[model samples]
Target: MPVPAKRRSSSKGRRGRANKGLAKKTLAKCSKCGKPTMPHHVCPFCGNYQGKEIIKSKVKKKAGSKK
Candidate 1:
């Protein structure tokens, strides 16, 4: 195997790795509940996709304090 003729600079290495950093996720707004969600995917909050309801979400009741 061949080795490098000289030591690589930290800035050069960092420049090469610049594109390897994690990118921000792309999100889209849900048509039904108006929540942020991934595009072309089912909405978790309203369970809607492409103007249709894919899942039937259940309403949770709030617990009352006992007197």
Candidate 2:
């Protein structure tokens, strides 16, 4: 087994992590709702994918509940 001779410095570690920041997700417009969404995914706002309805998203009611 091998071991490091000395402890690593914080500056050196930070330099390596300089480019580790997360990149913003690329968004594509939903064909049906025309809203921004991730590519190749069902639209969360309208529950449609590739111009067709796929997963049925829950609908939110305004103000008080009907029941």
Candidate 3:
């Protein structure tokens, strides 16, 4: 193995480590529900993706009906 006998190698290693903020992830909003969600993924709040509903969020409310 060849050893580095220069100061250039130390600075090069830190360059990549200091630029992590440039690669921050961004989340997109759903057009239907107006909620933040990952890009290219189905919106969990309204269960929609790509102008289509992928999942349904329906809850049946029980009525206190006296028989």
TM-score of each: 0.58, 0.59, 0.49
The local lDDT score (0 to 100) that residue 12 gets in candidate 2 is: 93
Off by over 4 Å in 3: 1-23, 58-67
Q: What ranges in model 1 sit over 4 Å off?
A: 1-19, 58-67
Instruction: Tell me how far the alpha carbon of residue 34 in candidate 1 is from the true structure, in angstroms, after superposition.
Output: 0.8
Q: List the residue pairs that clash in candidate 2.
A: none
Question: What is each predicted model's overall lDDT from 0 to 1?
Answer: 0.81, 0.82, 0.75
- Full candidate order by lDDT, most accurate first: 2, 1, 3
Instruction: Give one digit per residue, the lDDT tens place, for model 3 in 34-58.
Output: 8888999988777789889888744
Clashing pairs in 3: none
Error of 2 at 19 (Å): 5.0
Q: Which ten residues in a row are the worst by lDDT in model 3?
A: 58-67
lDDT per residue as tens, model 1, 32-54: 88889999999977778999988
